[model samples]
Target: MVAEKDANAAKEILQQFEAARTQVGELVTAAEKNNQHFDQLIAADNAAGHAIINQAIMALVAQTGSIERAAGIIGIDNLNPDTADHEF
Candidate 1:
């Protein structure tokens, strides 16, 4: 009778382990989806920031009447050419 009880307990433990594994898989899937959505949001925010910077730079250029002068005033002209090219 004790052996039979032990077998039953082992079966119960196996069931619980399966259930926990399934829950962990579901959590991982949800986390991956959340990360994908967060990445998209970050990309959109970066694009918006770039757009705002471009607009401001254009406005400055209009006021200054020369892109070079505008860049000089904003210190963009002082940046390393390679770094400035990559950033813009």
Candidate 2:
């Protein structure tokens, strides 16, 4: 009877070990999913940043076009004076 009790205790210990290992496995899976989410966020942020830059560039192009059209109507030269000396 004593040997049977010892065997039962060992079996309980083995069960506990398996349970602990299962918990660890679950945690590892969760961590991997979290890492993938982080990577997706980083990629999305980069794409958004590029979109913002593209919008700014488009806005600047529109503004410059307006300036040139206004200058053409007024018959005024819009040349920069800083580089005018190099033309000679």
Candidate 3:
């Protein structure tokens, strides 16, 4: 009876993990889509949009006290000096 209970518990845990994994996968897809849209918006030749985005990034950097940390929080990568010259 104890062995059966253990096996049942393991199966329940596995089912919950699978459900969580599916939910995470859906969230990742949504985030990716949103990121793509943001990239497109930033790529456009809109000075106001650029300024707003830069301001938001600067605010995050100021609040976090590190540009890298701000970028990480916003799911951005490769925020090096060369690429971020215009951003600051």
Please name the candidate that would achieve the greatest TM-score relative to the true structure: 2
> For candidate 2, lDDT tens digit of each residue in 1-88?
3224455544544554455555444434534764433244335556643443444445444444444444444556764434334432
Q: Evaluated with lDDT, which candidate comes out highest?
A: 3
- Candidate 1, residue 2: Cα displacement in angstroms equals 11
Candidate 3 least-lDDT 10 residues: 61-70
Q: Give the poorly placed runs of model 2, Cα more than 4 Å off.
A: 1-45, 78-88
lDDT of 2 at 26: 42
Clash pairs of candidate 3?
Answer: none
Better of 1 and 2 by lDDT: 2
Across 1-88, the per-residue lDDT of candidate 3 in tens digits comes to 2224455544544554455555444434534754534455466785644654555555444433343443454567776544344543
Cand. 2 TM to true fold: 0.36
Q: Estimate each model's TM-score.
A: 0.31, 0.36, 0.32
RMSD of each: 26.6, 33.0, 14.6
Clashes of each: 0, 0, 0
Which parts of model 3 have CA positions greater than 4 angstroms off? 1-5, 33-88
